[model samples]
Target: YKLIIHTDTLIGLSFSGVHTWLEMYGCEWDDQTGAADAFDQFGYDGEDFVSLDLKELRWISPVQQGIPTVQKWNNDRAYLESDKNYFSTECIEWLQKYVQYGKSSLKKTVSPQVSLLQKSSSSPVTCHATGFYPSGVTISWQKNGQEHHEDVDLGELLPNEDGTFQKTSTITVTLDEWKKNKFSCVVEHQGKTKTENEIRTNPEGSVPIGIIVGALAAVVLLVIIGVAGYMVYQKKKGFKPVSGSDDGSNSSAHTVPQA
Candidate 1:
């Protein structure tokens, strides 16, 4: 009574018992060598039956009417040999059991996304970048050292409903190539390639230190207004000229003597 049928119900009971055992015993064999001779006439001792257990075997009425069509043609040829090796883990567990029995259909195709941001106004440099399968990305802008892609500006590419896609790019430089020179962000996808760079140097403002402290406080206020106008011109040229008393003394006393 050793009935054991499983190797996926032995390919649908080897095609419904080889078309009813080839119209009652006139066989010829083909469907993969008649399913390897009907799993050696049912008692499959093939060493590997992929976890067998045909409901406690013991079937007869033509192997229980070809065991569920040979276990659905051995799970559709082991899901087409695990989708031709997509790093099969048993073809992803038989496509998660053919999408939990609803008999899956399959769909998924995403690959696109990239990013990079840069700014430099004399040393305060900043550059961030990213890119991965973004279909085909390209960005460029440089100065002080050359290479400027037409005023530079590119952004807009956001799609993710599983289709995959993203974008971001910016360029604004100065302060000596944003401090020094070298500034870049180039990416090209679909063929695989990437690049990112930054080199800084410019920084020193405050109106040039307030125009050198307003020209040294206007030359110390013109040397304190020329020493306060030369001390008010020496106190109006050292005033005082009282000469009336010089001869007055003699005239008054000698009026009656020496005329």
Candidate 2:
């Protein structure tokens, strides 16, 4: 069954006029129950503009601004019938193929490699989790063995080129703060947690030069994203591509063991 809520004033629907957007229609099917669902939704600037009512097999407009186009689409008998047939049959076939193609990789889970990174002495310390499968992980910081939240920055879940995923959480702390308290990074993935002391005092008075220059581009990027948010694409509960993440070529990477 299709889910549609109708009210006179477009109650919860948000509309935007500044940007233009259009979402391709979506279709879903259940293999075991032989059930099917379909939707043709259009959005403009993140606003729900219009959608097709599969139950009535007609186009319905949530807001008044979309009415004119809705009227035109609802009047097109051939277009309506063609859409109905396509969603009921063609879409399901493609969805099934997609399920078969990615099922093995999508169901597999690989443990992540966790590390703490700092571009320079003054840069924010980052806890990085990479080479994990299925794209879900939790990266957090702890001070004195307790959860620490202030001045923490959570990064976007990004894809890697090797079919795994990577993520990072960064924290800004002063040299005095580090000297006064113990700081650690905790990464939880697939029911296991890895906790490691993120800051180390190099008695040699120097860190690998490559480590400082390693991922310089990424460090600059983190500063930009810390100030301005990054773009994220919303994928429905279906198949999507995941390219491997580029874990930089820093030879002195300190990795924590999985528990």
Candidate 3:
């Protein structure tokens, strides 16, 4: 027997008296000729094949077939007919929870909004502080307890492509003045004031004083040795000492006849 199902009504037609078992075995038939060949090989009536309607045949197997296909069809229909408003509500709720507790949040916080450039030295004492920023800023200089304005050089503000600005400031003074002075750069932006100060010192001139003292000591020692040697020579040769005259009152001195 051969059976075929092609409708949503789930009807199956079988030929011959080979029953469903033969139909199961003959399911590999490719066409009408193949079905007739299988029937002949299985000892079924090739000339008198019977037509069967399997629509009322209740499947008695323990395993229920076609479950996965039915479930897929149902899911596709549901997705086609359902509204997306429920999903949008879920997304809004998730965002609210993230904003409330900062959990599952993916936003980047703004940085400290500051950068310091390298201070360049023009003289042994004076230097220029240069940097860039994202907005308008202020720059100033202070020496000791007084504000320094004269001789302070301020560079022109250059606007960056990202709407930020940069500027440089220079101050000139003696190395000694720099050591005694305190220089600061103040920036005012977004209603906030930030200040950076650089105090100068003579690192190169602060060499060891002990070295100079040691050199002087060596020169004094050589001079003392040379003077002592000259005094010893004058005493040994009976020459009058250069300091003062002898009194001639010693016991070793005697009166001598005139020669």
Candidate 4:
């Protein structure tokens, strides 16, 4: 029988003029034999700066700029030894408690809100899913219950201020396709519940409400202009109407004479 033991820690720091923002320490051992197989120190100094491979007794990614820092760290063995001592004595216990709290808190789930919208006839339909926990979520486009890949644009998962993740998937469809069938956006997350939004087809030859209203207004304006023009044309042709009786009595109706 074989068993293995592994421990690692990651720490991040931000300071003025400090390019080294992140660091990690990793060590692995064989449990049954009680012998370590690997111990490593890796860091990022504006990039992957350097790594100490204790198993090989060598350094990896020894950039010219980082060589001096590596040499200085290696020569000051006492400080490195002190760091390891602190991690084993004080950090491990606190890390374990934090891990336990994470596991318990993650058991609670939040459902995502799915929205399906289209910007215009020329644009694709956007499937936006937001406010979900545990970032490992799948958002996809489905056409009539089957997975669709063609003409689909997938967006990156972005973190929100509330610690939740949001993603969007868009699918290009012509006006005919949008009016002929239905499409859906499906979201699958860690929780048992799944959320989806269905976009139903619009009626054939249907236009947006704004466009419809504008067309009607145009027609009404044209009709008004045509009637006004006809009245002006009749007056220009020298057609005259008989005046009404001055008293409040019905007068004989008289038609304008033809020009």
Q: Evaluated with TM-score, which candidate comes out highest?
A: 2
> lDDT: which candidate is best?
2
lDDT of 3 by residue, 1-259 (tens): 2222111111234774332211111112223353221111111122222221122211122223433433443344333222122122322232333344543223322122332233334342223222334335566666664677877777655433332344556666665665576755555644565566653444443522322444455566679789997876555223211112235332121111111
Q: Tell me the spans in candidate 1 whose CA falls farther than 4 Å from its real position.
A: 1-51, 54-116, 119-179, 186-190, 194-259
TM-score of 1: 0.21
TM-score of 2: 0.44
Summarize candidate 1's per-residue lDDT along 1-259 as a digit string, tens digits. Answer: 1112111122224643531111100111232342211111233323221222222322222444456544653455443332232212222332333344443222322333233322224333332222233334555555544676644566544333232344555665555544465666655655554555643322443222222444455566678779987865555322121223333342211000000
Using all chains and alpha carbons, the TM-scores for the candidates as numbered come to 0.21, 0.44, 0.28, 0.43
| Model 1 lowest lDDT segment of ten | 250-259
Cα lDDT computed for each candidate against the true fold? 0.36, 0.66, 0.37, 0.56
Report backbone clashes per prediction: 8, 7, 2, 0
Model 3, residue 172: C-alpha shift (Å): 1.0
Ten residues in a row with the worst lDDT in model 3?
250-259
Q: After superposition, how far is residue 254 of candidate 4 from its true place, in Å?
A: 99
Q: After superposing candidate 2, which stretches have Cα over 4 Å from the reference?
A: 1-29, 34-95, 198-259
Rank list by lDDT = 2, 4, 3, 1
Q: What is the lDDT of residue 195 in candidate 4?
A: 46
Order candidates by TM-score, high to low: 2, 4, 3, 1
